[model samples]
Target: MPQSRHLATELPGPRSRALMARKTSAVAGGVGTTVPVFAARAGGGIVEDVDGNRFVDLGSGIAVTTVGASNPAVVAAVQEQVAAFTHTCFMVTPYEPYVAVAEKLNEVTPGDHAKKTALFNSGAEAVENAVKIARHATGRDAVVVFDHAYHGRTNLTMAMTAKAMPYKSGFGPFAGEVYRAPMSYPFRDPEGMTGEQAAARAIAVIEAQVGADQVACVVIEPVQGEGGFIEPAPGFLPALAAWCRQSGALFVADEVQTGVARTGDWFACDREGVVPDLVVVAKGVAGGMPLSAVTGRAELVDAVHTGGLGGTYGGNPVACAAALAALDSVERDGLLQRARAVEALVTGRLHALAARDSRVGDVRGRGAMLAVELVGADGLTPDPALAAAVAGAAKAQGVIVLTCGTHGNVLRFLPPLTISDELLHDAFDVLDAAFAATSTTTASAR
Candidate 1:
């Protein structure tokens, strides 16, 4: 088996703390708190901190390195592209890498209909552009999104987003004509609403309140990412897609966190065979480079006049090259299928943990994009304090984990699909130990 973490000293040793201070001094004012350990380098499933502590990387840079950090093919392709030439700016002088990536996206994204793709620099830009295309195509003003959805952080996306604490708090006076609806949250929905019933209720609200005729698009994350990895019930997404088609509303699937094989399919929209008019992709697109895109129906994409969509570094050559190689690597290596295998590994461990601990309210997600939601003994109330403690304890044990959700009580795991089975299992073992230890501490405190 690969070597497990070797912790020679405490995390954030003297050297790491000094670096953190330098970062705080030099970096922007609003940058968030640095995590427990400062990474020196990462590969496969492990990140080495400056203090020589090896940590099992379960976060995968917030789901950006699905094909793995510094993948050989991605590194080689980027190096080759840099050696020849870097950016000519896709707007001024377009390059093949950008076109090639767009072509691949057109062919690979869920829709089989005639499709077009435009690249951008971040998930928020892709989402904003998707909305622009939808509004242009429908000539409508309103866009409807679900409660608990996380589109992005830009002003327009912030308006579309449903969570208010961090992504929307104090950041608003947001864009107008954005509406919110309920999600098919199986865990929390009313006593008897089936998945289909939940979807129907939401549609009713849209038709009666928002007026389908005035809505330009309906956007969703097939599996709610930041809202705690809540997978929509079986029939919800397809039914919504059908409703959008009948209402002349464009369906935009925000696959920024759930796309690129992280969820057992090239896109979650494909898993349900519910092709959206637009699909926003980023995070894992460039194998860690800053790149994003909107892929959708050709007519909808072309509806925007030429030069209406694009940015200065939308499809930078280096990132484009990395994306092409990453996509190829994902396909050739069967990372999509590998994602399911990783999911099984995670669920097997996490569900077992849930079985014993009442604090673990749920283990839910598809493929590698999984999370374990924490709750108090009542099994309904969110347990944010326990979740934070669990994450901090895991970090002390030389493992990286992330917490997210509307209530901030979900421990999300986004290990790279390229992580070895042994490494994944090792991380789970560490998690199991951490949970056991934390449970003991909780018992003692009580």
Candidate 2:
């Protein structure tokens, strides 16, 4: 279907409100929704709620629908695969689709070196397994992650993740041997701190505190997602990768939100030629299907014992089929170029907004994955209130924007590559009005 934003009624119309009431009664409070309006259909860039509201899909189901939510190829592949077989379990009766997906991941993920791939049910699972493989391979226990990093929600990942509020609050007794290091946040770093210097600072922390030799891997998101769409300054990733090589630690890229052409590259690390020893991928990998993978060096991955890896539903045939279709769409539809086009269009508008509004503290990210970090008058204090105000306003106006960052102050954009430029511009119109209205409200309060 053609993409366009249209609100037939007030946000979360009566029908949606009714459904939400039922949801509250039946669902866990932790399972949240950005908007109460449930989706009836989604195609191109529009997610039509049950109440006939067509919202511009800026979140892309949290960056999972990179090929659009209802791509014909993905739908057909899924249907065909489901008809043939749902699951015999890859471990029990290994399937061709699983092998195909692993082959494709090995081909596309950064680095020409001989690589292997292990598929899983979610990004967190892939990350956990990656750490397991790295630890076993390197014979080291300590794992280093950067500040403002968001690995996942599982016990070990929660320990690796830096944030403590929504992701970590009440989820305690996290796994051990996970160490945190400073990130190369150019926007917050001291004036004139180069990426190399920032990398050196992080390395110093790892060496002095964690001891480089004890490190099994340095895991990082090439462009942070939940911790804000932070793009570490140039040379940051390479320096860490080099250090990993020197210290016999694996370099791991948590490209869950920045991989599979979402960043205009197969993986975000490809942008600077920083190939990781292991690449953990999810979100956008299977065109909305729940699938993730740990793809990297064959030697390191194979080092794990034969029965050391895998889950029962790790590489479901249906999800693998969907992934194959999604991969095909990336190459055939030129989604890599499409992502860059999105970056140009959205980044231009975001920068223009930042130029005029001091609240838009920083505009950063790559390709369709972009964000506007909100801040107070000092331009340093995070303005999560304003960010919430803008996002809430945009959702009401039919633009489905999402908020993130450890401070909850970053309005992140993850539009589908298939979105029409007209729809994007229309969403931005709502965003512009939202910013202006919120600014006026805050000004009045002050």
Candidate 3:
């Protein structure tokens, strides 16, 4: 089979089918999967299934492998760290790699305002900790989040998330004092509403309903990840940050999916020159290792008591070692520029597709994180069925694509930064074919 993408048999071939049977009995139903074929190995935008089929990976394991799933440097670092020591528990006995990773985060995150970092095991934990720090620092209780936001799965974060079906359904007794504000979704926003105007609208609600003085922090994703990869209108983020500053509310940037050179910048907020008081990072941070962090102003982070913020696996030495090496790969490999290049290729193709198909209502996003919102014949009604059909067609053709958005009518592309140009273009070709196939079927059904 070719290194790029080759199918020796149908998707979820014999070996994969056998594995699926085992997984069905062992794994819980709630833990879903996109592709049924179990991966034997993955690297450089290609996943090889146990059945010997190769697939082009457009979904970089949901953007967790920005530096590639098995980056050599990260692998070596993990190996060395495991050999030395896996986990002594940072709270029990601190290690050099943990402190070093925190230092690196402080230096790289936006602003030179004497930042500090607290590591966690996942984005949700980091977000929960950020809320804790904010409340402690401000002596306020209310925490503000945006509509179309996806924080995490923890109880508090599930409350922070906007969507209700899968993430919030059946879960109850959520954290209180969490206020939801309207996001600056340009495509859905009223026509001619500038970013500043949108910010003012959300701020008005915050002031009126939540009371700015009662709010400790206003947490938002500069480019919302699960909310259809929605990039806020220009000037929107800066305006919100300014309001947070004036109103004495901490501004938190949930960059879990947008950080680590994923959005063509160190952080998406950097594009707008918006320096958030607190930034949550995960997913691509450690080259697929389970690690997350909250990096923020010194005073706010230090406001917590000496033993206030920590977990047993927070800043695990192995994960920290992987992060250090992954950071080096990002800088040395110039993945930031590469992410921009990917945006150009993907957006160009998606925009052309929209021109040819009315079902593609909007093509938007930045860097490697892009999405196309599917609509019905009238071009306004969301067509989630079409999105699902397109995604299924692509998957059958050995291209791994992921669907997201509040309505599940958006097809998001989050290819690894290290994906070769040839492979990326091939994946787009598969997508184009998928859209074409799905559109024809839809027209016939109508």
**Model 1, span 1-446: residue lDDT tens:** 13467787877787788988888899996667527567788777778888888888888899999998888899999999999888889999988999999999999998679999999999999999999999999999999999888988899999988788878889879999999999998877777777788899899999988998999999999999888888888889989999999999999999999999999999988877888889999999999999999999998899899899999999999999999999998899999999999999899888888777778877899889999988886778998888888888888888889999899999999999989888788788888887887784232111
**Which candidate tops lDDT?**
2
Residue pairs in candidate 2 whose N, alpha carbon or C atoms collide under 3 angstroms: none
Taken over the whole model, the C-alpha lDDT of each candidate is: 0.88, 0.93, 0.92
Instruction: Give candidate 3's TM-score.
Output: 0.98
Error of 3 at 282 (Å): 0.6
Q: Can you write out model 2's per-residue Cα lDDT over 49-161, one digit (the tens) per residue? A: 89899999899999999999889999999999999999999989999999999999999999899999999999999999999999999999999998999999999999999
Please rank every candidate by lDDT, starting with the best: 2, 3, 1
| Each prediction's TM-score versus the true structure | 0.96, 0.98, 0.98
Per-residue lDDT of 330 in model 2: 100
1 or 2: which has the higher TM-score?
2
Q: Rank the candidates by TM-score, best first.
A: 2, 3, 1
Evaluation by TM-score, superior candidate among 1 and 3: 3
Q: What TM-score does model 1 achieve against the real structure?
A: 0.96
